[model samples]
Target: MALIETRDLRRVYDLDAGRVVALDSVSLDIDKGDFVAVMGPSGSGKSTFMNLVGCLDKPTTGHYRLADTAVERLDADGLARLRNREIGFVFQQFNLLPRVDALGNVELPMVYAGFDRRTRRERALHALGRVGLAERAHHRPMQLSGGQQQRVAIARALVNGPSLLLADEPTGALDSRTANEIMALFQELNREGVTIVLVTHDAEVGRHAHRLIRFRDGRVTEDHRQVPVDARALAREAAE
Candidate 1:
């Protein structure tokens, strides 16, 4: 079954000014292990789609299913539980606590999930290692480079073993080199069977995904599979 499914999904906001249609009858399916990049200009419904798929928001007039569970049927608490278990979010800002070290930041999710201290430590360490940051676990976010900090954030998102990784312009804060490194990491993770849905305005970053989905004026304008560029190779080429 597809990891994500939406049919005639729509989101409308009743503002003081008037009603704003943020999403308009969008329908699509994202298969397990697919690496999809969502692209659009500001106010083009891409963010709205991400929010709905991430269980962060509900569609006002349509159906959505994540791993076959009907999203609209879930209560607020149920949506929270689904998000906690099935989705990992990576934001452009990294969102790390200034006072906490990488290990501690990664452990926050598990703590909320009621994991014991030992298990949280073990899992956080493993997650850091996955992002090639095991040695930086003791370092605070301030001490790490931009790429390293983003890596830590990615590790935190993965610590819960979520079925889907939803990244919002994850490479936006980095330089080209750093962004390429992060994209390489994402490609590597996707090859390891982690389904990823990335929202970005950068065309270079979007080309690294196996599929491209473009939104415009509250509708999907394009959706197609493509041969992804090799991000790791591009990074290495830049280094040379």
Candidate 2:
């Protein structure tokens, strides 16, 4: 079965100005290990779609089945559990606690999930190692570079061993070189069979994904497969 299946997914809001349609009749299936990028201009429904797909918000009217579980049927606690078990989120800001070191930040999710102290430390360290940040585990967020902070965020996201990763402009805050490094890490994760759904406004960033889906005016305007740009290759060429 597809990992994520949405049929006619629609979200509408009733504001003082009558009604607003944030998303309309959207349908798509994201397979396991798929690397899909969602792109659009402001108010194009991309963020709305991401919110719905990440289970942060429910659709006003539509069908969304995540891992064959009816998402629309889940209560608040069920939704929280599903998100904790099945989804990891990476944001543009690399939202780490300023006073905490990398290890502490990465352990937060496990703490919420009720992992034992020892287990949380072990898993957080392993996740940091996976993102090439093992040696920097003790560094606080302020002590790290932009790329390093973002790596810490990625490590935290992966610490849960989530099946699906939802990243919103993961590289948007970094310099070109740093952005390339982050994208390379994402590509590596994709190769290792982690499904990713990334939302970005940059076409260059979106081109790194295997599939592209574009939104416009509360609807899907484009969806297709493409040969992804090799982030590793780009980084190599830059170093040469």
Candidate 3:
């Protein structure tokens, strides 16, 4: 079964001046281990779609079945529980706690999930190692470089071993070199059987994904498969 399936998903916002449609009859399916990139101009419903997929918001109409569970049928607490268990979010900002070290920040989610301290520490350490940040686990966000901080954020996202990774403009704040590095890490993770859905306005960044879905006027205008550019190759070329 498709990991994420949405049929005629729609979202509308009521305002004093009537209603505004943020997503209009959108439908798509994302399978396990697929790396899909969402692209669109500002106000094109990309963020709205991401929010719905991430369970941060619900749709106004239509069906969304995540892992075969009807999302629209879930209550607030149920949705929150599902999100915590199934989705990992990486934002443009690192979003690390300023006062906490990398290990502590990564362990926060597990704490909320009711994990014991020992298990949380072990899992957080493993996640940090996966992101190549194990050496910096004790460092605070301020002590790390932009790339390092973003790595920490990725570690925190993966610490729960979520079924899906949702990244929204995750490389927007980094320099080109660091962005390439981050993309390489994402590529590596995708190869390891992690499903990823990323939203970005940058075409260059989108080219790294196996599938691209473009949005316009609250609708998906284009969807296509592509041979993704090798981020590791690009990084190597830059170093030469």
Candidate 4:
């Protein structure tokens, strides 16, 4: 079954003088375990689509099924619960709590999910290890490099054991080297079968994904898959 399916999804904003259609009848299906990239120019409705998929906004019309549940039908509390359980988000900004250490920041979501102290610590540690940050777990955001801080944020997102990882320009604030490092980590996670959806306008950033879906004027403009990343190239890059 598809992990995400949408049909005629629309979001309309009513202004005093006019009605603006942010998303106009976009229909799509993203299979389970797919690494999909969403691309668009500014004002092209991609942000609106991301908001709906992330459960931050409801559709103005039509239907959306996420993991086989009708997202449009869920009440606010139901949506919140589902989001807490099934979605992990990484933003352009690292979004780490400056006052907390890396482990504490990673444990925040579990705290919201009602995990106990011991279990939260273990799971958060495992997540940090997965992102190659286990040794830096005690450092604060200010003490880490940009790449290290982003790794901590990625660990936090995964600590929830979410079914889907959604990232919006996760590399926007980083230097090319740091961004590539984060993308490599995401590629590794995708290989481990974590479904991922990333929103990016940069073609370089989107190239990391297995599939691409382009948006224009509130509709899907293109959808296609790319060749797998060359193993030798990846290894060579890793050695650099």
Candidate 5:
């Protein structure tokens, strides 16, 4: 079964002027271990789609199934639980706590999930190791470079072993070199059997994904599979 399946998804916002349709009957399926990138211009419903898929918001009407569970049938509490258990979110802003070190930041999710302190520490450290930031576990966000901080954010997102990674412009804040590094890390994670759906406006960033879905006027205008550019190779060439 597809890791994510949405059928006739629609979202509308009621304003004083009138109702504005943000997502207009969108439907798509993302399979397990797939790397899909969502691309669109402003107000094209990319963020709206991500929000619904990430469980941050619900669609006005549609059917959404994540790994065989009916998302549209879940209540608020159930959605929160499902989100915490199955979805990991990475945003443009690092969103790390200002006073928390890398380990603490990564452990926050496990803490919310009722993990014991010992297990939280172990898992957080393991996640940091996976992101190549184990040595910086004690470093605060302010102490790390932009790329390193993003690595910490990625580690935090993965600490819970979520079934899907939802990244919304995760590399937007980085320089080209740092952005490539982050994309390389994402590619590596996807290769290791993690499903990923990323929303990116940058064509260069989207090129790293195996599939691209472009939205326009609150609908999907294009969806196509492509040979992804090798982010790690680009990073290596930049270093050379």
Candidate 6:
């Protein structure tokens, strides 16, 4: 089923100079368990679309349905509740608490979800393990490398078992080598059936997804999937 559907989605800002259309009547659908990437230049509507999809902002017009819930009709509190349960976000900055260890960082979402201490601990450990960070669970963010820190951030995003993972420029701050490692992690998660929507300007990064959606001048310009990466390529990557 389509987990996300948007029909003529739009966002407009009333500026001093004139009305600015940040998003212009965009329509799209993303099915469950799909790995999709959104790519565009600075002024494109991709970021605006991401905000709407992430429930961080409301659309100016049209419809947005996420997991069968009409996003536009929800009140602020309702939206917050839905977001808490349904969306997991990974940002470019890693966004970890400097003093907090990996386990504590992963436990944060469960704390917000009101899980009991024991359950939170168990789930946090499992999530950290999923990201291959179990051994470093006690290490502070500053003690970890950039790739490891991003993995912790990924674990935190997964701790709540959210229906969707929304990543915004997740590798933007990392070096090429570190970025590839994180992308491989994302692929692993997707292979395990997590739905992912990644936003990036890098074409190589965007190509990692099962499908690509490109935006330009506040509208969608292309939506298509390319050939999957070969196993040989993946094996070579792993050996590096």
Q: Write the per-residue lDDT of candidate 5 for residues 212-231, one digit (tens) a residue.
A: 99999899999999855346
Per-residue lDDT tens digits of candidate 2, residues 1-240? 578999999999899988999999999998777789999999999999999999999999999998778999999998898888888999999999999999999999898899999999999999999999999999999999999999999999888988799999999999999999999999899877788999999999998999999999999999988855345543443564
TM-score of each: 0.93, 0.93, 0.93, 0.92, 0.94, 0.92
Q: In lDDT terms, how accurate is model 4? A: 0.90
lDDT value for model 1: 0.93
Between prediction 4 and prediction 5, which has the larger TM-score? 5
Per-candidate RMSD vs. true structure?
5.9, 5.9, 5.9, 5.4, 5.9, 5.5
After superposition, candidate 3 runs with Cα above 4 Å error:
228-240
Instruction: List runs of model 5 lying over 4 Å from the truth.
Output: 228-240
Cα lDDT of model 4 by residue, 1-89, tens digit? 67799999999989887998989999998866678999999888999999999988899999999987899999998888878888998
Q: Write the per-residue lDDT of candidate 1 for residues 1-240, one digit (tens) a residue.
A: 678999999999999999999999999998777899999999999999999999999999999999879999999999988888889999999999989999999998898788999999999999999999999999999999999999999999999999899999999999999999999999999877788999999999999999999999999999978854346534443564
Clashing pairs in 2: none
Which pairs of residues collide in model 6? none
lDDT of candidate 4 at residue 227, scale 0 to 100: 49
Q: Which 10-residue span in candidate 3 carries the lowest summed lDDT?
A: 228-237
Clash pairs (backbone) in predicted model 3: none
- In angstroms, the error of model 2 at 36 is 0.4
Q: Return whichever of 2 and 6 wins on TM-score.
A: 2
Top candidate (lDDT):
1
Residue 10's lDDT in candidate 5: 98
- lDDT of all predictions, in order shown? 0.93, 0.91, 0.91, 0.90, 0.91, 0.90
